[model samples]
Target: MCGFWRRYFFLKTLRGLRVLAYSPVTRPTIVPFDDFVLQEMMYAYKHPDTIKTDDEWIRWIFRLRRRERRHALEFVEGWSGTRIAIAGTTPWLASCLVGIIWSAARGNIQTAFTVAGFILTSSTVILAVLAIISSVESSNRAVT
Candidate 1:
């Protein structure tokens, strides 16, 4: 009778644990044990199912690879365009800055801080434009 009662309590506790494990509200936040992932992988590789997974796995891998390649190409394109635009425009901007700084240099002979401030402000704008272009390209979005 004692053994039977102990077994019954043990089973009841396990049943409760199973219920709690699957409950959305009461489910554990973390796994408490290692599932021996490598062992399962070795077993799966050794034991081929009637429904082959190799082809499916290969297709999935290829799909992911293509997606990554596409992202990389888009990133290069966006940056290349942004870089060309900035390069083409920067010469004019630099000349303008130099003229402004030269005038300031005549005034106080102290144009270092003014040049630094202008450079910093312009660099921030360029970086923001680059980021926006990259994000738009990656998302395949058109800016209206």
Candidate 2:
């Protein structure tokens, strides 16, 4: 519950700041996380232009990796809407499932059914919205 609220408010803050301005019509290219780390390390360690005799090697490597991650995240901001929606709803869904199970264990079939119906309805709505967003984004990209 705490995590959900934190994430929700964090996203809300970002939206308020308009920090998520760029919305690509397609998902950004995904570089595997480990691969990106390894590549960044190699570039930082072996690239003569960045090598130094000081103890700043760790700082340099972290700075370079952070910058790359920032760019990747920026490029992937278009998927944030769907991602945020799913993330925000996941905890509620899980809790509902738990509640339904508990109700069934107590032989409250009616309660279980009611919760199940709500879950099904909410899930359908969420999925439909995601589908519509995906189709619209794809069509927009095609038009451009």
Candidate 3:
């Protein structure tokens, strides 16, 4: 059972990557939707009995909305970093996000939360680091 869920989540992540690679325009939505679906799938696995409840389902839907917001911010961050000559944080962030989703798929809430927090915090740190690097470069360029 656990293995199945893990594989499903992994495949879902692959599909999201494939979609992003094939269609850049819908990436913002697709990435978040992928996260949301993975989360809900985990949630469902943990709480199978509540599947019949509308409220329970709605909560899962809200997770999608949350993902969408996060996705938009990430996309904007990526774009700005690219434009400002900042180092790209996408590879680091993507790996962390993948770890978080994998944790969730295993139906381990504690692990999932820890992984999610790590990913979010590290992503912020990487972005800040890149911004500082860009600022330093800009200052150097100005002085030269």
Clashes per prediction? 0, 0, 0
lDDT rank order: 2, 3, 1
User: What TM-score, over all chains together, does every model reach?
Assistant: 0.26, 0.33, 0.32
CA lDDT of every candidate: 0.44, 0.51, 0.48
lDDT of 3 at 29: 40
Q: Give the runs in model 1 whose Cα sits over 4 Å from its true position.
A: 1-78, 81-105, 111-116, 141-144
- Number of the predicted model whose lDDT against the real structure is largest: 2
User: Candidate 1 — worst ten consecutive residues by lDDT sum?
Assistant: 11-20
Residue 109 displacement (Å), model 1: 3.2
- Could you tell which candidate, 1 or 3, scores higher by TM-score? 3
The TM-score of candidate 3 is 0.32
Where is model 2 more than 4 Å wrong at Cα?
A: 1-100
- The residue pairs found clashing in candidate 2 are none
| Backbone-clash count (model 2) | 0
Ranking by TM-score: 2, 3, 1
| Per-residue alpha-carbon lDDT of candidate 2 for residues 1-144, written as tens digits (9 for 90 to 100) | 236633443332222101121224544344345655555555654464775666676564355364223322322213356565775577577657866796869888677767776776776676567557655654565452
